[model samples]
Target: MPSIAGTYKHYKNENFDEYFSAVGVPYMGRKMMGLSSPQMDITVDGDQMTIKTSSLMRKVEYTFKLGEEYEEHMPDTVLKCVTKIQNDNEIITESVIPATGEKCGRHYLFTDDECVITLTHDKAKVPAKRYFKRVTS
Candidate 1:
């Protein structure tokens, strides 16, 4: 679970927060609905996680153990997500958003030095990449 915890720490870091906030973060980007441009905020405390978005269109909150499956709703969609380890250093999550039958995949790779999150939506055939620096404990 070190990798999962590391990924959370990376996202909670001050530098990563500043950088992500400065950029106009786009998940699905220009191809999707107008609601796709929401600003994202993630909060993690131990194994619990909550994701908040600025857009009034959609918001989500959930708690799950690592390697467990959970259901959540995003903007105009409902998703079933499973968090699993891709390798010793990566946490990979695949989500199925039920509304449009869209499947999205996310990979979180962690190292002593950095962390990177890559999100790919299979329906649109497009991907978005985001990186974070490890937060020192």
Candidate 2:
């Protein structure tokens, strides 16, 4: 089985201010940062996974079987996601906002010692790319 466990560095240049801000904040009533480049570590075991960014922001942990649907709430956004194996070398996980139904597609590619994830919107517009170097300890 392909394992997805590593620290991933992400870069985002999407127009988040235009769309995310329009949705407004969840409880604080403050807008999210217009741009963010946060690094997160994702650990996947079986069909369960946890993605952590930091102490204050990382608290969500969800589990879902491959080809099954699940709900995920991250900070102020709520999304419905499905995990599937796109091919022998790649896993494709697509997420859609429950409120707006806007789709965000994510593709994870695993090689011998490297992992890459490309994130985009419904229109196939690239919003971010995350690169990870497998570590051994």
> What overall lDDT goes with each candidate model?
0.54, 0.61
Candidate 1 has an lDDT of: 0.54
What are the per-residue Cα lDDT tens digits for candidate 2 across 76-128? Answer: 67788988765555778889988777888778887666667666775433355
Taking the candidates one at a time, how many backbone clashes does each contain?
Answer: 0, 0
lDDT of 2 at 27: 29
lDDT of 1 by residue, 72-98 (tens): 765445688987656767767889877
Scored against the true structure, residue 61 in model 2 reaches a CA lDDT of 51
Q: What is the TM-score of each candidate against the true structure?
A: 0.57, 0.61
RMSD of 1: 8.0
Error of 2 at 128 (Å): 1.3
Candidate number with greatest lDDT: 2
Model 2 Cα displacement at 42 (Å)? Answer: 5.9
